[model samples]
Target: MDTRYITSAAKPEQLPDFDLPELAFIGRSNTGKSSLLNALLGRRSLARHGRTPGQTQMINFFSVNDKVVLADLPGYGYNVARRDVAKHWQPMVDTYVRRPNITAFLCLHDCRRNFQELDERLMFMLGRQLPIILVLTKTDKATRNEIRKQKEKLKKRMDELGIDYQVIIETSATKNQGIAELKALVLDPHLQVEDENS
Candidate 1:
């Protein structure tokens, strides 16, 4: 259960050589990505939580039990007014996800808000290549009925897009919900074996 930050890369060339299997976490800014990582690792500060949008601008990597890597990719769809700054993230993220040794992708979305067009586009792009685990974060902020509605809406959109049914998890970092399920997915033996064979 040991965890430690490895490095933060701003570009593809700056990324460390991939040796262990990696499960990358990505989402829009302030989608509880950092909090979820901390909850999963049982650490209070593995990934820094910030109030500011686009606080995590680098591709941060962490080693878990020295067996696998967890990459905290920079959040997208932030600072829409600064199109130039936000534009660079697409290429960087695209390159990192395409890298070798990536086992799966965890795409987090805030349950309090409706899924945006950008989210759909990103999911569509990533879904085409990797096994995507759609995580609905901040569920504690919404009521049971609201959460159910949000899940249904997202599923319908995915179905329309021909995205096969994937594991969709509802999580609340404050409530410690879905943490175990997420950990199970990340540490699944099949994924580890896939990395070993690759």
Candidate 2:
């Protein structure tokens, strides 16, 4: 019923060896990924809170009830002067995205800014492979009217992309809204296995 932070690892090989489903969280820098994680778990300081925009350079793994795994992926966005450190991210992140255990990816985009060129490019590279659920972050900063308008815009984009089983969810980690529905859609059934034990 509740999700919690398990661990943070730098390398993919260090990820815990378990067949449990993995719900990965990904987004652009300053898109409220860390805050959303804490909000989803109903805790304030569960995931490392960082002030720097592009702070999550390494991949973080969080376990949920021993049956599911929540992976906190590094945020993708331009960080002036620190570009070299993130050189290895896109490729490595792509691999993990394509991995079989990746039940679903929460591809967050700042609602204030429409999805960017980089986001579009990554979506193309993914090539209809992994199931992705787009999360519109930072709703608390916008007016209700503005949020609805953005949702319509993003919906049109998804339709144009022909992405199947994809969904767009609006959330404000600060407001604690849309957290439950997002979890239900991605984490619950996406990774659910037909019980072999059954």
Candidate maximizing TM-score: 1
What total of clashing residue pairs does each candidate reach? 0, 1
Cα shift from native, residue 37, model 2 (Å) = 0.6
Looking at candidate 1, the ten consecutive residues that score lowest on lDDT are 189-198
lDDT (tens digit, per residue) of candidate 1 on 1-198: 778889899876788986788888999888989999999998899898767788667889988888889999887777555777667776788788887788788899998777788887888888888757788899889998998888888888888887643578888999998887778766762432211100
What TM-score does model 1 achieve against the real structure?
A: 0.91
RMSD of each: 4.7, 5.6
- Using lDDT as the measure, the top candidate is 1
The residue pairs in collision within model 1 are none
TM-score of each: 0.91, 0.85
Model 2 TM? 0.85
Q: Total backbone clashes of model 2?
A: 1
Model 2: lDDT to the true structure: 0.71
